[model samples]
Target: MKVMTVFGTRPEAIKMAPVVKALEASPHIQAQTVVTGQHREMLDQVLTLFEIQPDHDLNIMKEGQTLSDITRSALQGLESALERFQPDLVLAQGDTTTAFVAGLAAFYAKIPVGHVEAGLRTNNIYEPFPEEMNRRMLSTLTNLHFPPTAESRENLLREGHRSEDIFITGNTVCDALQTMVANLPPGRPPELSHLPPNCRILLVETHRRENLGEPMQEICRALRRLVKDFTSVEIVFSVHKNPRVREVVFPALEGHERVTLLEPVDYPVLIRLMRE
Candidate 1:
């Protein structure tokens, strides 16, 4: 049967790349990748890292786009793709807007939906905002729930989902890590490559709009305290492009000798940097 994988965002692509490879390797299965391009540039980076050429690119990103906009765009775009591709099954990864909307579209199309990295719940709906709600709704429509861990499987069970349909496949994030790191590029930045041997490298990413004000300030204060406490450790933070995040993180981290705040690094470089 043909399997169409719909995803957007870098993290979803990383986790789904292995599934795409597996489907390609299987003689009976044909895997088609569809990217919503919710995170146009970053999603493309992961796609290149995995050497995946998407069958369809729904460039749905818009400035000042809200959650409603993403959900509507992905649903409408992926619905057309589902009809055109006429796949036997639809697969989506994680709790991204693209994933949730794709699953919903497939459900409407009466195509079986398989959710990868499913069953993750903060339970507190608003803590992760729409993500928690997205996963919950996706779980309702998922014919196959590929939970990343036994704990996640148990969580699905507690939510009254069937046990037989839930599969405890260890987190595919680890699988992606193994595959992506094997062919990592060489000659990284001098600042990163020249760090002290075996020195701890901290990677910080913060981009939730709700945390822009006080929470961000608190995070900056914590980092400043951390740098002060550990003078020898090195930090390479990839600041988000959001002006709000930049405004808060940069001013707070300035003048710290050990911390190097830089623009976003590509996937391979970020992976290599994280490994060291």
Candidate 2:
């Protein structure tokens, strides 16, 4: 059986890498990979770390792109691929625009779609913006639901999803973490250039766009206070690319000696930073 796995974005790649590997290992299944290139640079970074080269890359990245651009591009691009490849089933994972659009393409082609990491619900449709709605809609079109946990399967059950179609696969995130960490080389991330003898390193990331403006300022203030009170500890924060976050974060922790605010590190560097 031929199975085409579609994913974009770093998190989706990380989670789906193991699934792709498993599918490749199965003698009965032939696996194909596609990357929507929604987050081109970041997606490639994770793919390289996982050593996954896509069979198709929909390189649809654009400056000032909107959600519609992604959906439309993935739909148009993946639709043609679906027609050409004609896989037995299309597999998509996570709550990303790429995942939903790929699954939608499969549905439109009258092809079965297997949704990995299915049935995760915050229940507040708009909390994760369109992602929550995308997942819900994909569930409707999918032939198989691979729930990561019992809680996720329960959520699907509550939403009237068929029990026979749901499979409890546990979370694939742990697999990625283990693989990356075990393979990560020494002395990465310039922020971790200096380690105090045998001292432990702690990594913190706080640049969620949702937490900008007042929330960001508040977090900065709290971090500053913690740095002031704690003399022995060192805090390294990977700053976001957004100018809004930079404006608030810089001013809030300007004079702090212990806190280091650095530019965003790549995935491998991030993994090393986290491990240190």
TM-score of each: 0.94, 0.91
Q: Which stretches of candidate 1 lie over 4 Å from their true place?
A: 185-189, 193-200
lDDT of 1: 0.87
Which candidate ranks first by TM-score, i.e. highest?
1
What C-alpha lDDT do the candidate models reach, one value each?
0.87, 0.85
Worst 10 residues of 2 by lDDT: 194-203
lDDT of each residue in 135-166, candidate 1, tens digit only = 99999999999998898998999989899999
lDDT of 2 by residue, 115-189 (tens): 999999999888677789989999998899999999999999998989999999888898888887887777755
Instruction: Give the range where candidate 1 is weakest over 10 consecutive residues by summed lDDT.
Output: 185-194
lDDT of 1 at 49: 76
